[model samples]
Target chain A: MSKVNIALDIMGGDLGPHVLLDAAKKSLEHYSDLHITLCGHSSVYQSFINTLSGDLKARITLEECDEVVSMSDKPTTALRQKKQSSMRRAIDLVEQRKADACVSSGNTGALMAMAYYVLKTLPGISRPALISWLPKAQGKKVLLLDLGASVNCDAEGLFQYAVMGSVFAKLCAGVESPKVALLNVGEEDIKGNTLVKHADQLLRDSQSVDYIGYVEGDQIFAGKADVVVTDGFTGNIALKSSEGIAKLVIDELKRLTTENFTARLLSKLALPFLKKLYQRMNPDQYNGASLIGLRGIVVKSHGNANSEASFYAIKQAYEEAKNAVPDKIKTKIESVLMEH
Target chain B: MSKVNIALDIMGGDLGPHVLLDAAKKSLEHYSDLHITLCGHSSVYQSFINTLSGDLKARITLEECDEVVSMSDKPTTALRQKKQSSMRRAIDLVEQRKADACVSSGNTGALMAMAYYVLKTLPGISRPALISWLPKAQGKKVLLLDLGASVNCDAEGLFQYAVMGSVFAKLCAGVESPKVALLNVGEEDIKGNTLVKHADQLLRDSQSVDYIGYVEGDQIFAGKADVVVTDGFTGNIALKSSEGIAKLVIDELKRLTTENFTARLLSKLALPFLKKLYQRMNPDQYNGASLIGLRGIVVKSHGNANSEASFYAIKQAYEEAKNAVPDKIKTKIESVLMEH
Candidate 1:
């Protein structure tokens, strides 16, 4: 891969710019050909720059921005008012081709709005979806899209998402002609609302997508399909619900294993395995949700993301940049739409 | 508690009528004051009747129905064509006042349609919702409604759900002035789609409900509110997604524990704790989801329910019947709406 550059929105995320700065440093060390342009308050970068070696310092660039898009900021306000914000600056870097991708752990809606305003959608795509990889059976991952980018999606919007997700699964997840499915309440032909049912038909008729019918929420991790597409509302709730349950289970396990001396001793042996399981299942570990169907690559990390999670987001941006995800999606969508 | 009479749809569920019959027997054994009216193919009951003691036999009544509502049957077809079906007959028993509640593991849509047609909605309620209990932190459970009964709910519909859920939480879940919340992508006032925002305003304006603002999917199990209300699509997907992740975690743990002899031996001590955790978290074990906003109580079990799960459904029906949940909801909705 050629030099993959990611513009990091350091002022964004709950842990603040310091954590993101640490992640940026870690990411540079991990990816040999990766370059990071830190966009945030200049003072945080100043103190951190002293620790980096000459080789590392030479690769990193600081693009100082005065404003920060807080987690509570409305998307419209962030888009119209926060032009000089760190999140906007990061996306600006991507648009200017100074960075191949933009990574932010800021407000999702604001990031999305700014990205849409700055990067614009790819040709043949109506909207850009927040696509993320979810763990499936056999150590495989499935691509779930529109995780909160576009809430009230019409049938055509959902159909576009299907094509985009299929393209993403193939290009980014390394699946060939990825089997795509619509997320509905039931797998039956007569299931779901009008939007999903219509989208299902559109997907079934498409020659470009390997449409595999519907999969309910419980079947999401059953390795039923390579990509699952749904409107942002359902997708966001489903994703968060999965995270909630995973956390609940982990908490319950922790409580159970320490309830008694016998349990504690037994759990000591299983601790390593438990840690590995946590790492695999934790949503924080799966750090980035890339805004696909756009002219430029933009990865949105979780708002509450720590340094580790932020590093994973940078890593995600590096991979997507290397894969040229947006270009592939644009190509795939154009070919798929032309068939109709 | 008085003798709680429950009409059982024996011919429904994946395990066939035999599993329901087993559940009926178990329910009768567990709840001494409970009487069951079995509505299904009489041949299944006739053969088993010989083994029952006179005391148990006297408490049971068989209401023979020729037709069965299959899981795949459309709601309209089940309502129009299958009047003589087991599910319909069970619901009819409730309508006729022969049974206090009806229990079914049949098609949810079919059950909802038949129940709505036969029993009708409460005085101020427009649509019925499938309300189920979800485990929260500290051994508590939160009430999640509209699991798949009503899709495409408007602001008024969602607001009504909030009111109904609040009533249910107070009466059934034993919460005083239950805190109600609308489930959305984010907790912010600016978050969520148009329906939720409108509903939030309505809920806030209402004096009857203890409206606690919006909650995200991850907070559903965090005990943030006593009741969580959402449209059927989001609620169903969120629920099934939670189930999927929980199952995945369990499956992963099983694989990890059995990977080596040391791990296997260690897990043996933690086996009981794990089993308890599974029981608490498993969706199958939380068998019944009651249809609220109706004139009568109708508990819908999982279609693929085992005898154990089916028994829990029967137990759920018995409790609802004893509590006169329908009457309570009717009074609550009428009183709450009258304030407007």
Candidate 2:
């Protein structure tokens, strides 16, 4: 397979250049021909290259972008002010077609704004959605749309989400026929608010995706459906809450093991198995989410993502770019809409 | 403590008389003065009374309701069409001072409609909220407000949630200070939409309850605060989704344990600890949600709640009713808002 060059926002992310530098160095091991454009503080990039003296230095190109988007800054303010931010510069590379795609562990709202402003949306799409993969208890994963992008959505907007999520599931997850479900208050067809019910009917009648019956909030991880569609507000809350609760469960288990000497000894015995089990449920292992339905590929990492996550994020961007995910989604959208 | 009397909607649940009858019989074992008004199919009550001999029959009064509200039935149609439904008759008893409170494991929307229309809201309250007690990883439970009552909420509605949740938390959880937190997309004051931000400002500035700043959705299980206030729509989705995911996790754990010999051995070894862990995390183990700030106390049990859960539901309603929780909530609301 040919190597895919990706623009890495070195100065972006919670841990900054350390994560990006590590991810960049790690990428070379898997893809010898892969070239990385390090868009960040020059000193930060050079110091990472300074650690490796061989062809690694020659393989990495440093592009200085001194200004950075702060996690606390508002998206609009960041867009107006942080013109020279590493994330902004990374999006510019994707826009210029200098790189196949871009990866950033920066401010999500700011990244979306910059991505849309730079790459724009694909044909027939009003706005792009941030589609993330949720680990199901079934050992598989489901693709969720508008994880934090669109808060206020209507029926038409939700229909678009189904199409986008279906395509993402197919191309990324390698699912032949992605089962799409509308996230509702209840499983009954007539249940939920008018918006969700309308969206459910529309998805059912559409040829764009295989519509599963109405699914409730918890069914997202049940593996009954491959793509769960909902408004950004609900999706965001579900995603965060699930993550929170999962962490809570783990913490509980940890607390239980330490409650007594017998339990602590047993916990020590179960360490490997428990670690393996928790690994399967880890969200960071899946990498960053893609800004789908955009003209160019843009992946947004969690701002608090670490080096290990950033490495997976770079691979995510490369995978999407190499798989021609945008073109596949465009084709799917066209084929389905044409029938409509 | 005085034994509390409850109007039990025997025909209102998904499983109908079997679960209700079993639960009612079980509840009577614990509370000798607990009187059960079995409003449902006369046949079901007769069979149940026949099985329970001399002493049990005297404490249980069977009223011929005959009608039932199905899970999928429309709330409005169920109320208007099924006039003789157990749900309606059960709430009617509360309205007529025949019972202290009513318990239902039926259609939630219909139950809410019945409770509001028949029993009415408390004075000075616009709409009553569905308040649920959720067990956090902290070994204690916290109160979640407006699960599905009010949808299009403004600053005032959220403030009212704070007061209702605080009062409910105090009575149910016995929190002295009852630290309240506004559930937002993020913990920052400016993180949420205009409504939440405005509500946060009001909650912080108001002298009503102990506003402990903004809380993210994930912190709910962490027991970060006593009362987590949110708009109905968001709260409903968060609560339902969390329940769903928790069930999904347990289901997955069951599947994993039953996989093979090694897993089965592991499951057996962990059974004692896992059972308690799962029990503590179970939603059914806690009291079903109560419609706080109403003219009378009304508790809604899980639609698919088992015998133990149903018994707890009645016990919860009876206990809260005995405490005159609604009056206390009204008093708290008046004292706070009137001063403001």
Candidate 3:
């Protein structure tokens, strides 16, 4: 409830800096104790700053950067070359202790690389992972991790992810002794690739994790586990595939509603309920994917995020900052290592 | 059209033998020229056969087996022991040329193992792949391969899947020159693990395939590519995740409609269109997933398939048999190898 300083890459995302600036303005209005450090070009910030008033003006600061990380820029290129980039500057703010957390809707790989280079991983953690929550039935949420940060994970990496994810679910979702499960093709111990099979054994042997058995993709939203862990490659595909199917269903529903008079009338009558359903199932609501296991908190928003989604990402950073997620995760991981 | 023969495993699937029997009866009723070789306990077949008359009785033949391949049975167990299992016997019917193709709704792993052991791979194909078509928008379907057949696929395995999938799209889906793509986390050449990157280069250099660039999970149903290829781990997760989301959407819709009286009446008005949409997007309609790159045709139905879904699996077997799919795939792979 004290002032939470959050840094955001204003020049990031598919839309121009104005979208991020608008989100920053909205966040400033919504959260009275929130302070924002906007990292982007000075001209964009100057024009926006001229319109702000006393308290609002005092809460906002700018770190002018000369370069922008484009969506197509490779991770290696972004890290080695774009040192003065907005994305890098935002992460740099977090590392310099000027911001409690940093958020970006820029290129995911670039943001991840920059965060890894600047913020670094915590002790007892080998790598940072991309973790995000998705809506489950009955208004609950399931946290899925390693969305795309580290592909080709070993048993050790997967075991570490399990530990990190369990901590995240407990802290963020408030699940006491969060049930963690490994994502595989089938729930059986015999299913999936060798990596998962080995990871399964490691998870089962670990006393620190409240490790449940394996869960398949179909069980991800069935509320079987508080946290579902997988390698980045499989996790990314599963997440994106769900999004694709959701879009397909929505498009089909849209087409049906406009097809005939009866459907049109039905759609009109059912508009409120439909909107509620859409809101419940909307991907935009689950916008921020935080890079956990780092020394500093970093939330990566979706690349194609709209203003609302960008605001949600900022909210995520604020919450993570308030809770000091990275510190908590570090403590939890150390305890888990002690258990070993 | 000549008489197409398909062997059905009477004792498979989550449902009992009666479901497969009902499907067999339905297939016989629909296709007058179709002959079915039923593999299961003779007592079950005898009771069913008593009701039939004339050509219907003569068209159906029984291959009695004492054993059954349970869903819990390991692939190795089914392959080594249980040679006379209903599932194995059904496959044997195809191998013996008594039936053109066979259908089983048994354990996928067991079915794959049995089919590979009995029928063996085609001359140039290293391994078999599980492939099925998903409904795309505008009444098209996209073919996805290695659904759970080969978990750890190398670049050569992927390149072979592309060749087989391309041939499948052409022969089964009736596309002239199907556009084939490798599934990845991103669409760029620089994205994904090393396996896909190597496969991309191999696919690009191949003359046999009409290779499109990489596609992300969201593009699976965008109708952008005719065939999508990935290792079994990612493919299985992506496929099941899409199914999970589809089920989630449907359940949410049902909950919304039944929430209030107005919503109920609106649902009634939209009932016809909803039914049509459900039918079009139904997973049951796309039930059978054939194990390609084998010497003979074998269709693996979902374990939890209903009567309609089981019938669709049998139908898939009939079509694959009619098309001589294995022979076509063999020919295609040989040409691709010859080109190299």
Candidate 4:
């Protein structure tokens, strides 16, 4: 039987390996063929293993690496110097085909740098983009691109992003046309700056991708389009700001409920429905992002991710591997580039 | 009292003569020595005048303008063809020295174009920018510039924006030695693109303006700085997105609180506090933004404004006319340019 070996940098993530260890144990019990090669500090992983249930202990492989990459460390230098780090070792497993894919909730910049320098970009791909999903109004999700991968992007970069994001929406969210929108200052085709204007013209002209015209920042939450493309700078702002706004809104509700006795009664009555809605938009639930257009499948989870988030990152890797996202992105990008 | 004659575009705004009349009534009540020339359709102004209450009946003059510029009309053509439109007529009042400034809630583009065509930019001012106060924590506000005036801008323009915003914040918000920061992807001086990078260096090197280095988007609401500088595109997104997010957050709070019994109790307790916050951040409180660096004061009121908003716009005009924002901006920009 062909097996999918998944490598995880368990020593990463803000909550240490406990959250990941718990999730990995559960994940192992759920999937018989799932093999987790946890590359991390040996002592930490061993201590975790003795505490885990028998099933989890049987399915896990502890790979030791003394070095660790801090979140704020410079990506380029860390990639070159941290050759023996758990992050690099995990990517090395993917490079050697020991693992079908890799997952990390560590430093995004470091992970992206290591993935590019080691695993390398897919054939004919100019750049890789980070893509995340959020459940919209109708229980369907929208794929938002370049969440933090490339800080500086141009017309061509956005073009590539649109195609990758569209594919992710179709394969993952089941959107057929996957109505794509290029996030901009306004909805008008000519309303934005040179980068946006050029991207609009190019997207309209492209045959492979469905290029919906410009969409504003507010429209992002409404899930106006199945796929939204933007420069990393703006995309990152839109993502974090949306999450911040959601949290702020939730906090306000809690504040109102707890303010007085009568309001607390109201809050009690409204708790169930509100909980459902909160569950719907919670960032922890939608924690994983596929680093598409790379040679191997790479999932960049939230930096502050606990075990639950990192587990979602692993599941995201599992599903993304099934879809063959890297090869798909390469094919789509190459075809578009050739035609253009 | 020194009389400051101002032009009132009675035919402007979403709600025309009614709002204008009401605003003029309130405006005259405060500044008794202030004179207003109401320029609009003869019949419209006359109808309002016939119904005018209190002493304001004698405080306003009916200057009939045969043509009126709609919100959708192109400002350049409106100025050229609508020889007697209320907007054109208002700018004409400023040019003729019949009024110190003009206030309108008409087409933003048309108003901007007409002002530039008629009043022209102040010497050493390459472009005029619109500044708005973004609500931050602690009931404090930061001056955000060129919200939608210019689509694309260079480093020099933003450098000038810093100077203009600094002077405006000091005069308006009463912030002494207001901390100014460049809005960019990262707070580091080395962050952002060439436009921001060079601007950062210039701002750092500049002795005239208070340069507080680079500030990230998330930091905008943290009340970290008194003034934030950004290009029109990003500035427009930041401003509008904040408004949209604020509305969404408030709306979600209402939705969650009214969901059930618990929510009802929560809402009952929280509504008062929430309403106070909503009121504090309401755009109506600050309805006027001086078209900084113009030869004459030009205040752009909210397009969806009502009587109360119009009254606030009038109040802003009184302040600008009193503060001489146009003259202040002129001296500030010229000094910076001369130094450059």
Candidate 5:
């Protein structure tokens, strides 16, 4: 394997530069042939670099960025004004061929806007989608897309999402002939609105992918489909609601275990199995979400990701870069569009 | 208290007539002031009623219906073709002022359609919404509406949902001046699409109810707002996705506890607390969802609801009937629309 370079937006996310820097350092320790260009304020990098030495320090390069895109900044505002922001500078590195891929734990809207502006869309792809991995039953995982990028999508957009999502699942999750399904309220043909119904028709007609009809919300984690496609609004709510339910269950379990000494004793006895279950279902294990349909690879880390989560984002970037996912999607999408 | 009559669609639901009859018997035992008119094939009821005796049999009335609405029947088909079906006959009881409320564990779309056609919308209300109780963290429950009734809603429709949901929460949940919020992808005002943005503006200006800005999916279970409103598409997905995630956690925990002797022993020790937690979060506990905005009260039980779940649905119908929810919503919606 040759050296792979990644652009890191150190100023993005809720935890800021410290967490990104810590993740970068930890990631470098794991991958010997990896290099990173840290895009942020030069002074912050200067203070951090003083404590590192040798191979770790030699593998990293700091690129100074004057502006910072805050979590609340509007996407249009960030695109127009924050040219020198860490997120934009990092994406620019990918466009300039200085970095293999870019990873950002920033405001999703702004990061998406900057990536699309800098890298442009892949051939025959109108808009990009945010695709993430969700843990499924029986040690399986499924890819869910359009988390919140394009809120209101047409049939064409959803069809395009299915094409991109199928390719991503194949490349990233190692699923061959991925069974793609549209996320809907029910599995019946006549269930959803006009948009989904039309998309369902389009997908069924397309020969570029294996198009299963429709899968409901509960079937998302049942490993019924390798790739699930939906409009941004529905997908985003499903993802967040799933997360919220997971949190609620964990909170309830914690409350139960703390309510009595006998319960505490039982929890202690069950600690090993509980720990394994929690580890398997940990959100950090599935942190990086690919910003697919772009000309270059861009992975978006969760806005509030910790060091371990950020490290997974970097690892994801490396995987996509190695697999040449952007080029693969470009070719696949062009063929799909031509077929339609 | 005067007798509150409930019309039950005995032919509806996956479990069929037996479950409905069982639930009605249990409910009559619990509520002495309750009377039920079961609409279905009278022959089935005749044989079942022979087994019952005394007060239980005396309080029940059986109404014969020749046609039955199958689960797969479309809403339009059910409305146009199945006039004498159990579901329609049950709603007709409400329409003719013979029953104070109606309960159906049938196809939701068909039930909503039949109810809308028979009972008609309340004055000044354009469309009815599907409102249900969702368990919150602090043993609290919030009312979420438009679960799948209206797939596409404009700003005005969402505003009406807020008004209807607020009154329902206040009357049913016993919360005065219920805080109403629109369900969006983010908490910020600028988060969702044009429809939600427009709805947010309309809600803020309305003096009919207490309007909070926006609540995201995670906050739904956090009990941040008394009433959460969204389009039917999003609301249905959120509700189902939450159920899916909850099932995943429970399945995983069960898998873990059964893995070995130690874990199994621990689960036995913790069984009491686990049972209580499970009981608190059971979907059956929140099985009933009210079809609001109609001139008459109609509660739709889960299509697959068991005996206990169906009993809860009956209890919910009894509560709404006792509180005169339909009358209250009619008055409230008329006044709110007048003010607007």
Candidate 6:
């Protein structure tokens, strides 16, 4: 592997620079060929730099920016006013070709706005989508996209999402030929609204990708398809609903296990197996969501992510950079658009 | 409670007459004031009638119907062709005031189409919404609506759903002033698409229900509000997605528990507590989604529902009938529309 440069937004997220620095150090240690330019306030970066050893310091660079984008700032406000903010500067590094990719744990709306403005959309792409890898049954992972980027997408936009999502799954997830499906109320073609129905027809008519018919929300984790596409609103709600239910079930299980002596004894005996299952279902393992369809690679981490979760986000950025996902999507989308 | 009559579509559902008869017998025994008119082929009902004796036989009335609505029949096709279908006949009894309510475990689209055609909508209602009880974290349940009835709802349609849903919650769920919310991608006012954003404004301006601000998908199970409303497409996907995730987790847990001797022993000891929890979260307990906004009370049961599930659906119909849900929605909607 050759050296890969990553631009890190240090001033974003709930935990601020401390969590970002910790994740950066860990990621650098794991990948000897990795280099990161930490973009944030000079004083904050300087204090952290003083503690690093010669070898670690040599691999890290500081690109100071005095401004920061707050978690509450609107995406438009951030775009118009926060040009010097660390989030914007990190994305600038990607545009300037100084970094292979940019990673941010900031306000999602602000991060997307800044990335789109700086890197711009790839040819034949209207907007970027938020794509995440979700755990499926049988130890497989399915790629789910439009996780809240464009809320009211038209049929054309959804078709673009399908094309970009297929590219991401094939290049990043290593699925040779991805089977993509549109998320709808039912598996039938006549199920959803006009937008989805039109998109379904477009997908079926085009030979850009291997398009499966409609899939319901429950089929997402059933591992029936390699890629699932939907508007940002539905995808966002579905993702959060799944998480909320998982939390509810786990809490109820814990309460039940602790309420009885027999249950407690059995839980203790089955601790190892339960622990393994819980780890597999943990949300931290799937921390980063790629902002696909951009001219450059960008990954968005959860706002409240801890150091471990932030490291996973960095790993996602590294993987996408390694695979040249943006280039793959650009080439595939052009062919798809030409066919249409 | 006075004597309440329920029209049962015995020929519908995957289990056919067997499950319907079992559930009917169980319901009659539990509610002494209840009477059921079984609508199906006379030969099938006669065979079951020979098995029933005494009070059970006295409470059930068989209304023979020659035709049946298969699960695959489209809504429009069912309405045009299956006039004497068991599902259609059961609804017809409600329209004629021979029964207070109707329950059917047949094709949802078909049932909705027939019910709308026979009973018609309330004075100010344009379309009927599907309302169901969803389990929340604090051992409470929330009323969620438009679960798949009207896929493409306008702003006015969503506002009507809020009004009808609020009435249902107040009457059936027993909430004095239901805190109604519009389901969106984000809780912020600026989030979601044009339809939801317009509906959000209309909800705030209207004094029909206790209009809470926007709520995301996670908040649905968090017990933050009494009533949550969305377009049918989103609501259906969200509901199914939660169910899917729950199934996935339980399957994984079962696999882990059975993999080793220690886990299996522990699971055996914890069986009673686990069983109770499972029963509470069981979808069968939450069957029988009410098709609100119609002039008559109509409940749609899952097609694959067994005897236990069908019993819960019948219980739901009995509750709605006792409360006179249709009259309540009609009166409430009149006042709400006047206010707007």
How do all models score by TM-score? 0.96, 0.92, 0.97, 0.90, 0.97, 0.97
DockQ score of each predicted structure, in the order shown: 0.80, 0.51, 0.78, 0.34, 0.75, 0.77
- Model 6: per-residue Cα lDDT at residue A307: 91
Off by over 4 Å in 2: A51-58, A201-205, A330-340, B1-3, B14-18, B50-57, B150-155, B201-205, B255-262, B335-340
Report the lDDT tens digits of candidate 5 across residue range B1-340. Answer: 3999999999999987899899999999999999999999988788888888689888998899999999899999999999989999999999999999999998888998899999999888888999999888877888888898878778999998999999898888789789998888888766898989999999888899899888888888885799999999899999988888888888888888888887787778767877888888887889899999998999999989999999999999999999988888888887877887
In model 2, which residue pairs have backbone atoms overlapping below 3 Å? Answer: none
Ten residues in a row with the worst lDDT in model 3 chain B?
B265-274
What local lDDT score does residue B337 receive in model 6, on the 0 to 100 scale?
Answer: 66
Better of 4 and 6 by TM-score: 6
Residues B48-76 of candidate 6 have per-residue lDDT tens digits of 88887688889998898999999888888
TM-score of chain A of each: 0.96, 0.95, 0.97, 0.93, 0.96, 0.95
TM-score of chain A of 3: 0.97
Question: Candidate 3 at residue B84, lDDT?
Answer: 86
- The residue-by-residue lDDT of candidate 3 on B1-340, one tens digit each, is 3999898998888888888888998999988889999999998788888888777888998887999988888899889898989999988888898889999988888999889999999998888999999978766789999898988889999999999999888887799999999999998777889899999999888888899989989889884899999999899999998988888887888788887888888778767877877887899989999999999999999888999999999888888888889888988888888999
> What's the fnat for candidate 1, on a 0 to 1 scale?
0.79
For residue B117, give model 4's deviation from the true position in Å.
3.0
lDDT of 1: 0.87
For residues A194-247, write the lDDT of model 3, one tens digit per residue.
999999999888788899989888889885798999999999999988988888
**What global local distance difference test value does model 3 have?**
0.89
* Per-residue lDDT of candidate 5, residues A1-340 (tens digit): 3899999999988877899999999989999999999999998888888777688999999998999999889999999999989999999999999999999999988998889888998878878899999988987888998998878789999999999998888898788899999988888887998999999998888898899889888999894799989988889988988888788887888788877788787778767877888888888989999898988889999989999999999999999998899889988987876776
True contacts kept of each: 0.79, 0.39, 0.74, 0.21, 0.68, 0.79
**DockQ: the better of candidates 1 and 4:** 1
